[model samples]
Target: MNKLFRCCGALALGLALAAGGALGAPTPAGFVRAQGTQFTLDGKPYRYVGANYWYGGLLATQGPAGKARLATELDFLKQHGVANLRVMVGAEGLSNGYQYRVLQPLQPTQGQFDERIMAGLDYLLAELGKRQMKAVLHFTNTWEWSGGLGQYLEWNGYTGQPLPKNPGYSWDKYRAYIAQFYTCTPCQDAVATYIRYVLARTNSLTHKKYVNDPAIMAWEIINEPRPMLPAATPAFEAWMKQTAALVKSIDPNHLLTTGSEGDIATDNDMAVYERLHADPHIDYLTIHIWPKNWGWFRDTATAKGFPAVLARTTAYVNKHAAEAQKLGKPLVVEEFGLPRDGQTFTPAATTALRDQYCGALFGMAKGNTPASRVIAGYNFWAFGGAARPVPGQVFWKPGDAYMGDPGGEEQGLNSVFDADQSTWAVIDQYSKTIR
Candidate 1:
């Protein structure tokens, strides 16, 4: 609704429940870095196919019910060769937003932190470390879920303003208003404080400070951060550069990324993307292909049979890869997905189209393109494992199963379910080839 949103064997080969307690991550003892349009892990090429498990930390609860589900999901992913995870560490106090946030009120009041969610993250990192997996942890968001821009505005005393579709305003107008976060003094300080808090805190379970933890591959400034209006470009760029510098100044161990949805920059040129990423602090580049939202294809909710959509997607990935290559930074198509064949959310829906599209993208990551290996990897739009939203439910309610989806994304529209063996088979086949 808002945007397009590691390793081992042996212990990794065990059954889901029996694979518990697999020691700390077996990754090389250093962080990842950009090595000429490719990532290097301990001086070796780090080519991998990762999954977007934004709800991972939240799912690692001490409670029995959630813990079992979390175990099952992680084991399933590991069994199929998933090693890199992209997770959401962003959460704001509950807001009046329509889609009730899953993990909310992390900051009950401005500048105050929530210990509960912090422990949840601690447990998550501990588990990932045990499995020898790597993670990309994103901090903030441009959208509503996880208490992003709206919460920031409300916290800074700019309350009650209409957002996008509210009464009379447009999305760009609302985006310009949210753009206030780049320059607002109080908001900026609040974020810096949040960053410092997380970077310095030691994981309660792992007992390792976040800055020194190799379990994390990178720190994303925000999810899908962008300059909404033309005039907001300079300010956004300044913010991006300053934020990257600040993160590096604090944590020199992990890689950094802007989480920008590479596009024709507000300067009306794609070169702006390359220029902004030119900052030495940015270790890599990312792009999100929203075939449904971007109109490259039709969603099943309305129509069907857009076979040519995959062709358009291929071109987009290549174009962005060429741009990333020019900057000499690794590029990740970290977000892309197609709806199921008929766009059905029912558990019985077939993912034939989705599987074929994934195969093509995975092929590109594994050097099946004109440029031959310009893209390192890709994470599909989302993965909804072992979860089913309440029958006929529209908006996700509290305590509904964690489905690897953000609010407002139509239920099951893009989720790769545990039951989708065809999709998993495609993923497993690519797992050995993507590097």
Candidate 2:
């Protein structure tokens, strides 16, 4: 009887290998795969502390100086054990029109693309590949900082000028206008065309198709996609589903995420959050917690507000993690940030509060509890790298160095610069613990 049982086990193992090597699917080596609330790379568990490097691709677009900085920053991140990056694939529209938009957008016109920007993205991917680093490349954004969803609407002739935070537009008006993207047929079509174009691209430097590149861990639909209203919820969910299906059809090798801010983006409805991410095509779930933005942390002093801040953050992540578990997918808190000491916008200012907050959050992922197991990975808000904000510069200008903070926000706000040794110490410590 013992001999028969051993023979049966051997046969089952052989069959599993022949089919897909225990994953029950044919996933190529070096690709990240989500399997039952965990991330696997080359059939081994993969997790890491990472950063939000939104300007990485654009940096390569600049001349030699830019490429040099890009290389140096990548090296710095790798040395600190940050093998994963969340980056913008490209921005949209002409930079001259918007006061707060990324320079060198990939889609400058309606359907036309800027080849130079595309090449920059290619270069960024090649460099990441050489370092064995992974990137989650989001194709578009809901915010005006990137000329993203609003840009598509403008191109489709839905609006004369997109709702950027100009003098006349209010936050409520901007939200209402951008929300039209979900129901706009032409706007949706234009986005699909852009998506198809990008997916079909062959990396100029690496001679690899975007769909076939192992450096890319996943393709995010959009950054912080929100429905804005209950009436738009159906359209938003449909758009997400259709986009996921489209990307999967084009490139089934890489993973897909909604780039959602969990229930926050879903109109503060946890059920809506779960339902949207429950789509079969979405490989994993994602949530972004902003204590400052959410009004959970307000006091300038860390000791005054950190306890409440930490408590709220823990509860928010735990809530989404429970939902992720129910849906059988890993959860990544891809964007979380706190300001510098006293919320200052200078690199020289201390980041003691930010450091402590980051350490506690990283601990949540590395802990042995149920929430930790479900929370497979995370990326801090922004990696400012070597870029220092110009003195007295509140927002980004054309000649100013691009930091982790986007143009829409204060340049140094929540940026983790290369000189931040204390922050790096916390990040490196937890990064080592992850793997």
Candidate 3:
């Protein structure tokens, strides 16, 4: 038997003996399992062809209307062959006063869980379960609500245009805050408490009914975890190790992933990957990739060109996959996208760029040695009915000219959305069959 299969067989045997069940019990349909460098769903190799739902969880917190909206969005996604939905769970939602700035001292008698946020999550998961959809639920926000300094400043209303100056905080003081935030002790234990809560709820649901529901693909430790200040590596690593251990202790049947967006280039990046891959509790590795200066769409042609971009991205994926394979796991490209900055790309160039980038990556995956299947999956940056009209932001609402036109001035030429039936047809052709 192949070594990876043997490892998995051993794991299955251990779980069976521990549960006092028969050997060869069938894994659930739509379940993802390691197969060489790729993942197999329902015993068949599959690749992700999906879109991100950034505000799904946020909107789902609004009660009945929010639940209805979520159901509508998932139905649309299912119709479009979207096999996954990447959802965000902002840390702000968990704690009342834990904004982006300096961490407030925790009161001795604070509640451990946030009932409103938990109720929203419960509703979201119930909806996903009802639809039989899979979600890559990011436990933290990478944008304004990220952990550490970014979130701190954002909470204080520091826009990216005018980055905030440090409030003269000392590293020693900050380290203590980090410890509390990660541990959540005396303030209700943030990371460990949240993971335990999720596991308990899901396990209870499994025991009661819907044992086969695959509502969540994995628990993402943090969204785009990066060291804002010097000397954060040790603390971050310790927190990750402890959190992973705590999560695994409760939910051994599901998987765990680190939501590291691959933009921060540092020794810490490789170190984080190494630590996560070495930990047996982590089932997969995930990274996000957007071309250099992609936000500005600078060097539109070169940035969007197939050869220029794919070289670095493919190399990054390969390196991570190699690391994950050592630990009997798969590397998943959890997020990748080319945002349309208002200026640079004329309608024609924009459409061309999109097609070329998507096609090139798909082609490369097919020809590569380990095969893209070994890389688990790829989720596009986003999908929504209407885009926000911010100038530099990725999603912009359709202008008057393109109203009611599905093609929207680009016919699979260079845009992110599927321009024609042909674009999605091509995607279906190259992507691993996921149903």
lDDT of 3 by residue, 152-219 (tens): 43333333312122355564444334333332332225444545555565423234222234677767
Model 2, TM vs. native: 0.94
User: Model 3: residues >4 Å from true position, as ranges?
Assistant: 1-30, 62-68, 93-116, 141-143, 146-188, 202-213, 228-230, 262-265, 268-272, 293-307, 341-350, 371-373, 387-435
Candidate 1: which stretches are off by over 4 Å? 1-30, 161-169, 264-268, 299-305, 368-371
Q: How many clashes in candidate 3?
A: 14
Q: Report the lDDT tens digits of candidate 1 across residue range 1-435.
A: 012112322123232213322553433466776556667676456778888888887776647777788778778888888888888885876656555565555576678988888888888777778787888998888876677766777789976545433467676667767877777778877877888888888999778989989889999998888787766778878888888899999998788988877774353368668767788999888888777777665546423445567677778777878888787777887887877778767768788878888898887764234344457667776878898766787556766777766765667778888899999999999987775
Q: Which candidate number would show the highest TM-score if scored against the true structure?
A: 2
Clashing pairs in 1: 6-83, 6-133, 25-129, 25-132, 93-105
Q: By the lDDT metric, which is better: model 1 or model 3? A: 1
Off by over 4 Å in 2: 1-25, 160-165, 299-303
**Between prediction 1 and prediction 2, which has the larger TM-score?**
2
Estimate the overall C-alpha local distance difference test score of candidate 3: 0.52
Indicate the residue-level lDDT of 46 in model 1: 71
Scored against the true structure, residue 331 in model 2 reaches a CA lDDT of 94
Model 1, position 94, has a per-residue lDDT of: 68
Q: At residue 354, give the lDDT of candidate 3.
A: 47
